[model samples]
Target chain A: MKKEMVCISCPMGCHLTVEGEGDNWTVTGNSCKNGERYGIQEMTDPRRILPTTVVIKGAMISRLPVKTAQEIPKGKLFDAMDELSKVVVEAPVKVGDVVLKNVCDTGIDVIATKTMPAV
Target chain B: MYDIIVIGGGPAGLAAAVEAKKEGVDNILILERDRELGGILNQCIHNGFGLHTFKEQLTGPEYAGRYIDMAMDLKIPYKLNTMVLDMERKDDDTKVVHAINEEDGYMALEAKAVILTMGCRERTAGAIGIPGFRPAGVFTAGTAQRFINMEGYMTGKEVVILGSGDIGLIMARRMTLEGAHVKCVCEIMPYSNGLTRNIVQCLDDFNIPLKLSHTITFIHGKDRVEAVDVTQVDENLKPIPGTTETIPCDTLLLSVGLIPENEISRGAGVEIDRRTQGPSISELCETNLPGVFAAGNVVHVHDLVDFVSQEAALAGKGAARYVKGHLEEDINFTTVNGDGIGNVVPEKITVANLDDSVNCYMRVRKVSTDTVINCYIGDEKIATKKARKFVPAEMVNFKIKKSDLEKYHDGELKFVVEPKEA
Candidate 1:
């Protein structure tokens, strides 16, 4: 079976065609090698870096923006978000500070992207 | 009296203030209208920012935080929630910034040089003239982003975005993640006005249909949004009579475009560029008026925040030079938009003030493939840059070396896009 997908690796947005299923795949129509990798990963097991905000206490603002340190399994995005929703951290949180350690046991930590100074 | 006063504490202002301080300007003040310093970046919670500056993909707030930290570390004084009312040139070459806030009732700031970085505002439904009742469900894409990301409020259950801009595309995915059914994104233009990555990651990833060359003709809503009439347009963007389709959606998000907020700049008697709708500036980012400089979105809407910081840094350095009495007064050669180019920043350039090279940021009017951008000083071609693909959504910067300008000292520098073969 042939599957068609657009590579989101860069601004090029190459329209890729994968000729095989599972581990054996031949990707074409990619401008570069990264697009081929993206196409294959997208077909086999897609993953994305979840970027969102979590509630904060004693900060100038009500919420602190966060994202997974690395890309996680696509199926675990909502689960990670659900875990993030339950978190509440204090102010004086610096960027890269772990908001949720090993979020949803995906071995990926949810870290604060911006610093929140104590109000 | 301050040596430099930066209006708007967003990315541009913060970067300007920090750069001015590094340039040995001791007294600098940043006046921000918002209570916080980040500006619109506070609500822009999505990633894919600061890739050039920081060499990493960061969220909007994160990209802003790095600069905010730098400003704070440099001890840059900034007034929060202070709205600048007016600015006027004084007799002694200094400008006075009059602002009002709850803390400071009314104060006039005296500065040797002023940097305007007030940024841009989202164009609303009224700007587009969509035939509709003033409904509660209609919101700008940025406003919806603020509501969902910062305020933690759900905008709607069913959504129909009216533009394929980056904000609208991001919101389609954002609304989807939060359990909103995004029906479709409508763009009047044949090509999307957003980055191709956004079109793929935000829309294609979520299976959201993007209808190009289509527009919303009529919005059917009274108190709340009920439905919107979508229609396919002809080449001239006129709605075809039989192509109307009604999509029942509770919310309509408008992401038409952004206009630079330059009310204060106009009030200060700064010359406005008819094409950019921002301040007409030199290569050094100096405006028409002496001792006044403009950068970032107030000068023109930048596609990336990294470019905004880079441009604002130049303005800061320019302000420092003006204050220190080191800036050179040289004859400037005007820059003109030639074929296929929409507009170019730094409408003029002075040869003496340039260090090594000057980066001219510009956008093409439309998408072109296998094109060469040629910079001609009068009839003599000075430099040429080739691109595989060029789109209006992405800004292209061409660096012209001082050596190139020295060859053609007194002619108009025109940038034109031509076929690669030609």
Candidate 2:
């Protein structure tokens, strides 16, 4: 199969062409080495990070925003968001506070971006 | 005695004044450097402004006209052509502002509170460090716009735009419509910083070529711009050694970026945000100094004029509260930028009184697909949003509900941009 992809690794959108035969793949048209590797993995397994709001208790607001500290499996976006929805933290939370434990079991924590006050 | 005296008479200043008046501020005046009430809007002949504020599509002048008419109806005091040169804080509640106009020379005023809304200035070739001899055909995009749209003068027959900003894209089509051949638009960045609609309508629709990751390495000209040396760049933004192309053109318009005009703000001892090159303020638009406020481009460069109006209104209202002796000094919490984020606006956050919501504006340092922007209040997550694509060109606006703000008592607000899960 021949695959055409746009390299997002940098500002230079290098049109990538990937050819795969039986268990082997050859990539070309990548301006940089990192983009070549990114194209290969993007062709195989596409993953993304999940950023969503979570329920907050004892804070002034009903919900506080949180996101996976790093990228997770692209196929697990809904699962990650579901996990984040069920996650809640007490108010007076500080920035970078870990609100969720074992998010998607990817060993990544869901962290908060804004400070919240507690009564 | 007046609590605050705002500089500039543009939409930003006008909106600020109106907001202050609506907040019951009786002693407020606006100083405009132009004879008319509207600033840049006086010459903007196209539509597409005021979609967020009035919920109606209007031209730049029309939108500013609406606000000016509103200020007039509200009897907002404004002095035309009053150029503010210097500003300094008198004590805790007073500031000294000096200005000059054709009618009055070296006029000075004192106010209890001050609002800086001088707006922004276009980035010139000198700022970008482009190598070129002094020529007659080189002009800023805004200048060419004013010359053609307002002064009814032709800039040139052939043109080359240096940046893909909104103004440049708009001018690409404008120049094309005026029977000028726009050779191309050169941008060093991979993704365009302009609005998607503009890229489609202005460049794509007009059949203008947009060269990504390319820059004008040098200019070749004597008395007028004759040609530009275009070159592609590597990942590090350094021009690649072998790839160099030249295009012939008589005029070169630069729409690189807009810098906030805040010399007066710095002179007034106001805290400046290094990232946005504007003033750092709380959600109320109150600066670090008491009785001083900032809004619009003077605070941060806004892509849409409507957002500028919205922000200016907040500053105006905040100033009114300061004059009425109702401004809160409980701005204990501060907003901090985290990983992947370029900068955050309204650098301070005060949840002391959670009556109204707060809007936090920020930008990303790089472009990413399927990204997640998270807001953390110290150790806890307050908000997060999934983004399909994030670019440095667009400013992200996030609103924290008053109810949610009440939950977090005290901690620093942080914004983080990271790639989304697979």
Candidate 3:
């Protein structure tokens, strides 16, 4: 199998051509090792770190920005978004505070990116 | 009098204030119109920031938090919810900042040096003059970003984003995550103005079609945006007849362009650059007014936050040097934008300001392959940068070494992009 993709690891944006399967993959047209790894990742279990906001009560702002603790499967993005949208965190929340654990059964926790103090 | 007065508490302002404090400038003040110190970063929750500065891909809020922490660690005093009304350069060479806030009604503060980091504002539908009703669902891309990322509100369900700017690309993904069907992103230009990474991750990842060289000719609906007439354009960006396609969408987001918020800079008698619509500055980020410096989007729009932080640091150092009586007052040369170049920041350059190297940030006017950028100083080639391809979306930083100058010609320093013949 051959897969053509662009590496989003950096702004260099190397176009990668991934061929073969599993550990026997051959990635070409990559400028760096990150692109090679990204090609392999894409061919394998493609994952992405989802960053979104959830409801925050009594905070200076209405929403609190949070991101997945680990990269979740790309297919599970909207599932994670669906799971995260249901969450309502409170103010006085510190950065790195876990907003939701095991989101979408992906075993990745959603943590706060900003420190919100109660208004 | 304060040693340095940093305007706006965003990444640029925070970085400037922190760097000035590190430069041993004791009396420093930061005035932010927003209630929070992070400014736009507070609402920009997406990752891909701080790669150059922190060497890690961090979210916008996280990136801003690092600088905010740095400012707090240095005990830099900042006033929130304070709007700068005007700035005046007194005869004694000091600056009086007129500002108003709930805490400090209308007050005038004196400072030896001022750094302008008021940032930029998004161009709205009205600015673009799209043929449409002053509708309800039509929002600027940045405004929609704020609504979804900070206010916890979605702008619309079925959306058609006009202008494939980075903000619009970002919004296409943000809106998609919240269960909105992003129909497509339309760009009148032959290419997308947004970065390659954004086009790939935001639009491509979601399988959203990007119709290039196409523009919305007419918007339908009275109270809100309903459908827009999308039409393909010629090489000159003029819409072609018999090529109109109407896409039904509840929301129409315009990601046209950004204008620098520099009313106060003009009040201070700082010269403005027509192309950038921002304050023109020296290599030290100092404006024509000796003690006044400008950086970040207030000088010219930047593609990355790390560059903004880096540029602001230069302005901070410039302010510190000005306050310490070390900064040069003599303007050596004005930078000229030659063929194929869009805009260049630090429109002026001073001999004394050049250290190891000076960074000149710019964007190309259009797409070209095998591009060679030549930097000239009074008929002398000072620097050259070769890139496989240069696009308008990415900013090119051309560094001119102090050693390259050898002797100051005291004339125009120009940058011209030379494209390889096909």
When 1 and 3 are scored with lDDT, the better candidate is: 1
Off by over 4 Å in 2: A1-119
Models 1 onward score TM values of 0.95, 0.77, 0.97
Over B79-136, each residue of candidate 2 has an lDDT whose tens digit, in order, gives: 8878899988765557888988888788779998888889999999999998878688
lDDT of 3 by residue, B162-219 (tens): 9998899989999999999999999999899998878999998899999999999999
Candidate 1, superposed: residue stretches over 4 Å from native = A1-7, A10-40
Q: Give the TM-score of candidate 3.
A: 0.97
Place model 3 in a CAPRI quality band.
high
Residue-level lDDT tens digits of model 1 in B147-172: 88877789999999999989999999
State the DockQ, from 0 to 1, for candidate 2.
0.01
Residue A100 lDDT in candidate 2: 81
Please state the error at residue A67 of candidate 2 in Å.
45
List pairs with backbone clashes in candidate 1: none
lDDT of each: 0.90, 0.79, 0.89
Task: Give me the candidate number with maximum TM-score.
Answer: 3
DockQ of candidate 3 compared with the true complex: 0.82
